[model samples]
Target: MAFELSPLDRELSNKTINENGFSVYVSGKIKIDRSIKDIRHPRCKGKLHSSNLTTASVIISFFEEHWETLLRTVASVLNRAPSGLIKEIILVDDGSSRKYLKDELDNHLATAYPSGIVRVIHLEQRGGLIRAKTAGAREATGEVLIFLDSHCEAGINWLPPLLDPIAANYKTVVCPFIDIIDANTFEYRAQDEGARGAFDWELYYKRLPRLPEDRYHPDEPFDSPVMAGGLFAISAKWFWELGGYDPGLVIWGGEQYELSFKIWMCGGRMIDAPCSRIDHIYRKNSTNFPKAEFGDFVGRNYK
Candidate 1:
């Protein structure tokens, strides 16, 4: 499957924010490689295996995302992920208002993923990430449901490792080793495979180094206290049965912990698989997200 965006796409993809919230960058049309290979941990290479039984539908929720970033996200999945294992790619538009995002995106996907592998779902009104992901999950047909951020790029052979444990036990919810993609330069970088997501009482997440026990088996999946939330995979049956994501939670804050605690309290376990890795663009929420528009929704979670 080949992808070539039109001149209009290249122009829109070159869009950058250098104002108050973001770092300074030039406006003279920058070029980024769409087919950059991701760096993976050497330990994750030959030790992993996949099953033909447990297939997945990857759900990517987006609001008013950069035209190029969103396209690259989907392309990464197409380029790295196994076509047969990936039943469908669901792109959820949370009522975006950008002119370039509307018809142009629809037409782009129509050509890029013409094999009916990609499905674009447009919401009539804004529902934030929670609702957008929920909407995407509702439309998923695969046995396992995978969720990724709009700016994420999965590494080579990233899918099988995440699904292997799920195939063994469907109730397990798994997250890949999330690496940081430089927000400004679009450079793909690797992270310590032992690092996992953690947060404090205030619900702010940060990467914490793994303890001695975590490195006991570098190739094995380590149990995690919490997930980064933007990327993870859960069984379709368990997700709906576990009530999906909290419908009451708004925007993006506090949702990760909510799901984390939900999984633990309900006898389900969350694991961070070292074998599966993905790169996500490290963009600041203050500039790239829609949380500010729905700020008061944060109060709803506490109430």
Candidate 2:
């Protein structure tokens, strides 16, 4: 007798039945998010866990003009990453103009790093960061995937902190404390030295040093309902399981908010780890890509 597929499974199968050659099968009674145990570190049996948490892949999505900065960012990662970590670095070129990044970019990266782990995926047409990130995520092979912008600089011990929470079977999204650097002079500033990151209804981002007097503390691990997507890490399985970044968003704006909300409301948690810190270039005028139509996207996401 042929097994009958439930409505949710049928929907998921349909969604993945296209040219991608991958299928997403969802079950109605089984909650995909809760089915898996909490994220945890691997055992030291000298054997790889089926969960695949030993190594990590970093995704850096960049546009045309920021190629040089992207190179520098990758160099920083290579310089600071602890030994025997980082399985690979996936660089997604979201339609760049520089001949170096397209034709000779990979060669240059190979020459610079010489580790043979860096891979580049060039989009023939510009898909913006949202699409670029999705493309990179799809290609990522590591068990844990960390997403960072092209202009950010990695801090010492940055890689492990992002993966530690996930390794511990927390099943929660994790982000590090992000510091800002002046775009012109590269002067670094710690925007949130004492506190973790937070968000507000205004959609503005900030760091909260202390919990409010009336707020409830359950005595569990540190948890935040929302986190800045500028630098966040998650297991590759959970990422795709959460449906990845909403393809509905255009360019770069509401993607982070969507991930933050979905993780919390869908019965997962988001945390800000004070132990990890990354520096990002803050600019008065962004020269990377064209101004995105983020207002309409935000409205659609919120509504």
Candidate 3:
């Protein structure tokens, strides 16, 4: 007897067919008794092992003209990363006109690391950083997600510091101490005499001189007033649950400030680890201002 399927069951069946190319139907009832293994999608056939689940996804979002810097950043990550830690490096190209990034990155992936894990997502139109990050976040597959700027260079054992805190059940956001790179030459340098700092109401990020006692207690972990978005890690679930980065912010001014403040004000703590470090080149002049009109949005969001 062919029983009529309800709208809900029909919708589910359609989705399953579209996603897995197989639909579940019981012998006579509406219950779905088929195993996912029975799906006929060519990509679904495999002797899946649980060991493959230990992978991590690293996401980097960048715009035009940062291709070389991003390549160097990925190299640094691959060099210092522990074996069996990262599963994939996701590069979200926010409307870059450069053709070499795709060519160079593909060649490197083929010869250097052939895990078939390097994925590139190119947007047809330029979306700001928050949108780019959100797009990359939706496509990530690792148990843990680490976010880094396109121009960051990682330190030794950098992955462990970020992952360790989350593995120990810290749902809050984790960030490493960022050292600065010379804007002119892209050469890395130690933190300046006055480097550790946060953003003010004016949306300008400024550094303050380390306290005399700060040098004496270099080994101690302390609560930070804000987490720098250049490098931070969080469990995949919590990130989406908190609604991710606010999609309302424009190109690149105050999105980090909004994220840091959201994490602190909405029941999550931000911590800075002295043990982990990354170098970011500070551009003396940035051309990221979308419009003079959008400046008010920055003030309202951070104020």
**Poorest 10 consecutive residues by lDDT, candidate 3:** 31-40
TM-score of each: 0.87, 0.74, 0.72
- RMSD of each predicted structure: 4.9, 18.1, 20.3
- Give the per-residue lDDT of model 2 (tens digit) for 1-303: 112466766666556434122231321222211111111212211222224345788999887634445666777777676766788999999887778787688888778768678889999978778899999999989888889988767765566666777887646787876776444334445665334456778776666654653123321226665676778888888888789998877777777878887787777778766556677766454354454544455556454
True-structure lDDT of candidate 2: 0.66
Please identify which of the two predictions, 1 or 3, would achieve the higher TM-score against the true structure: 1
Model 1, 1-303: lDDT tens digits are 112446664444345443212122411233323555546656777774754558899999998777766777887787787668999999999888877778888887788678888878999988788889999999999999999998777888889888988887888999998887665455567766657678767656788888788677887888888898889999999898889888888766678888888888998889988878888767643654554567767666755
Among these predictions, the greatest lDDT belongs to 1
Clash count per candidate: 0, 10, 0
Better of 1 and 2 by lDDT: 1
Off by over 4 Å in 1: 1-15, 19-33, 288-293
Question: Could you tell me the TM-score of candidate 2?
Answer: 0.74
Which pairs clash in the backbone of model 3? none
Candidate 3: lDDT of 242? 76
Q: Return the lDDT, model 2, position 268.
A: 76
> In candidate 2, what residue range of length 10 has the lowest lDDT sum?
32-41
Q: In angstroms, what RMSD does candidate 1 have relative to the true structure?
A: 4.9
Q: List the residue pairs that clash in candidate 2.
A: 38-169, 39-168, 39-169, 39-170, 39-171, 40-167, 40-168, 40-169, 41-167, 41-168
